[model samples]
Target: MPRRRPNGVGLEVSALGLGCMGMSQTYGVPDDRESIATIHRALERGCFFFDTAESYGPFVNEELLGRALRGRREEAVIATKFGWEYEGTRRGALNSKPEHIRRVVDECLGRLKTDRIDVLYQHRVDLEVPIEEVAGAVGELIQAGKVLHFGLSEAGAGTIARAHEVCPVALLQTEYSLWERHIEQEILPAIRERGIGLVAYSPLGRGFLTSTALPAEEYPESDYRRHDPRFQGDNFTANTAAASVVREVAARREVTPAQIALAWLLHRGEDIVPIPGTKRRVTLEENLAAVDVVLDAEDLRRLDEALPPEAVAGTRYPEAVMHMNGR
Candidate 1:
């Protein structure tokens, strides 16, 4: 795996990183053994960047990654987030207060089984706690040697600018797959102006761009896809048809649709790094190999036109989840 510098400060990571959320929750049952093996395989393949959040599995995901990186922690760059409040094991409302941010990083350090976090994200913008305060809190942590870099997830453009003013944002984690292009208009340009790298989550459109995607109803009630707007009703049918362009392009290149989807993002810019999540080693290998699947001008054009922002139906998230994006 090749490395790319997402920021001018020389933060280099694998071209394609592994997203560790699915290993603990959302997509399916927890597979601790396999998830650990997948994480090891990623490191073995030279992909050392792994993404997880404090809210994921309400805290178990960080613990799981901690266990996986136990002896080999020196070879990985771990990125975890905070912002959501937790009462015991249950997650509560968004709370990015300065105190909350410091407390979460301390707790996350123990759960992650590491002394310092490679990258710390806000998880989601907290409207109540000003962005400057959040950034300042993270800045203090960075100065104290608890955090190496600062990032924001799903934050608005103005908020990003304001936060960066307080503390330089090294990366912005957001959903920016083919099906999710809402950030291109304002967010991308704003971050690019500041030279903040993009850490694209859901680079596979939550599996819709892949061949294994099933209807929303097909997923278990506990799965997040069950409530995703793009996976429901007529939107599923329409989105499926729109995603066919990926299959067509994959067929032409003799590569998997997932690879095509990831390759497209790679071609978008060197500043963009897509962290596609998977608990299985086989799937992990397939996603990492996307770095080698080159997309030409024609391929890029066809993909962009096939899935325009308007062509895809339904909001990226359900109404309740969309409420958090206001920041």
Candidate 2:
């Protein structure tokens, strides 16, 4: 797979990074041994960056990645987030206190079987903790040789500016796809000016863009999609309709809808690196192949016209989950 330089970060990662969230949580049950194999396969295929979060399996995903990268740690760029403090199954909260960041870095270091995190993101903007303080904490980690770079996830423009003032941000990971374009208004321009990269999560819209979303009643009760507004009632119907348009285009082009979506993101900007999640090798390879799909200006214009930002009928997350995002 061919790769491109993203700004001045000086780090070269695969065009499409693998999102490990589904291997441990969100999507469904997963085979640990198989997931590890999948990680190995991804590395063999040139995928150097792996994305995970503290909230993903609350910790399981990190441990899994740690084991998989035990000996090959130096070959991969590991990225994970901190800031969410889950008290119990029913109670979850955000905490980005400087002390909390120090503690989590120590924990992540142990769980990842590495001395330093290549990219340490503040999972989400912790409104309770000043952005300056958050950046300062990561800056200390950098000085201590515990973290190489700092990034933010789902942060607003104001928060990003404040955080960068404390420590230069190398990247900002957030939800951006054909269906989600809120970042285009402010986030993209801010990061572009600062020479920071954008790590796009859910570029496939949680499988909606791939034309595989289950019906409203088919999703498991514990499944996150069950509560997502886009997956419920009429919203899901409307969402599926838009997805069908992409499917039609893919069929006409002799490619998969998933490929079309990922390829579109690739053309969006060289600074954009999308991490599409999957637990099975079949789907993982399918997504990796997206790097080969070529799209022209006309294709992108058609996609942009068909699925405008906010074309999806409902919010990306349900109220409860939405509250936990972007702090």
Candidate 3:
């Protein structure tokens, strides 16, 4: 695998980072043995950028990464986040207090078994706490050598500018792919103008681009897609039809639809790094192979036209939690 730096920051990682959320929860049941093996395989294959969050499993995900990177910590660039206030073991509400940010970094270090975090993201902007304070807190951590870089996830363009004024934001982690182009409207311009790198999560459209997705109701309640509007009824049918464009190109290139989808993201720009999450080594290998897939001018044009922003049917998240994004 090759390497790509998301921004001008000193933090350069694998061209394709591995999203570790699925190993802990969201996608399917926990498979510790296979998940750990996949992590090891990722390192062996030179895909060393690993993404996890403290909010994921509320803490267990960081512990799992810590366990996986015990002896090979030096080979990986670890990125974890903190954003929610917890009630015992359950998440209660959004929290980004300066004191809480400091506390979370220390706790993350303990769980990740590292001296410092490579990139620390707010996860979501806390409306109660100003972003400057949030950036200031992380900036302090950076000065104290507890964090290497500052980042924000799903933040609005204005918030990005405000936070960058307080502390240089090296990266912005958000859901971006052929299917999710909402950020391109304003966030992309803001990030580029500020020289911040982009880490695109769900570059596969939550597995819809894999050509193997089921209806929303088919997924268990534990799975996030079961609630994703794009996976429901008429939306699912229409979205699936639109995705046929990916399959057509894949078949023409003699590759998988996933490979075609990921290749297009890679061609989109050098500043963009898509962290497609998978818990299985087989799937991991398939995704990493996408780095080698080439998309010509024709392929890019067709793909760009296939899933126009208007073509995508439901909102990425449910209305209940939609308020949490782009704050």
lDDT tens per residue, model 2, 1-327: 667666676867788888999898877677898899889988988987899877788788899999999899988989999977766633266789999999989989898889989889998777888999999999999999999999899888888888988899998999988788878977899889988899999989888788687866788876778777888899988888877768877887788999998988998989999999887778888888888888877777778888887688988877666865554
Every model: Cα RMSD to truth: 0.8, 1.6, 0.8
- Per residue, candidate 3 scores C-alpha lDDT tens digits across 1-327 of 999977977678999999999998989899988999999999999999999999988799999999999989899999999999898788988899999999989999999999989999999989999999999999999999989999899999999999999999999999998889999889999999989999999999999999779999999999999999999999999999998999999998999999988898899889999999999999999999999999889988898888887789999999999988997
Q: What is the full ranking by lDDT, best candidate first?
A: 1, 3, 2
Better of 1 and 2 by lDDT: 1
Q: On a 0 to 1 TM-score scale, where does candidate 3 land against the true structure?
A: 0.99
Candidate 2 minimal-lDDT segment of 10 residues: 84-93
Which portions of model 3 show Cα errors greater than 4 Å?
A: none
Candidate 1 local lDDT, 207-244, one digit each (tens): 98999998899999999899999999999999999999
For the record, the alpha-carbon RMSD of candidate 1 to the native fold, in angstroms, is 0.8
TM-score of each predicted structure versus truth? 0.99, 0.96, 0.99
Q: Which pairs clash (backbone N, Cα, C closer than 3 Å) in model 1?
A: none
- Clashes (backbone N, CA, C under 3 Å), per candidate, total 0, 0, 1
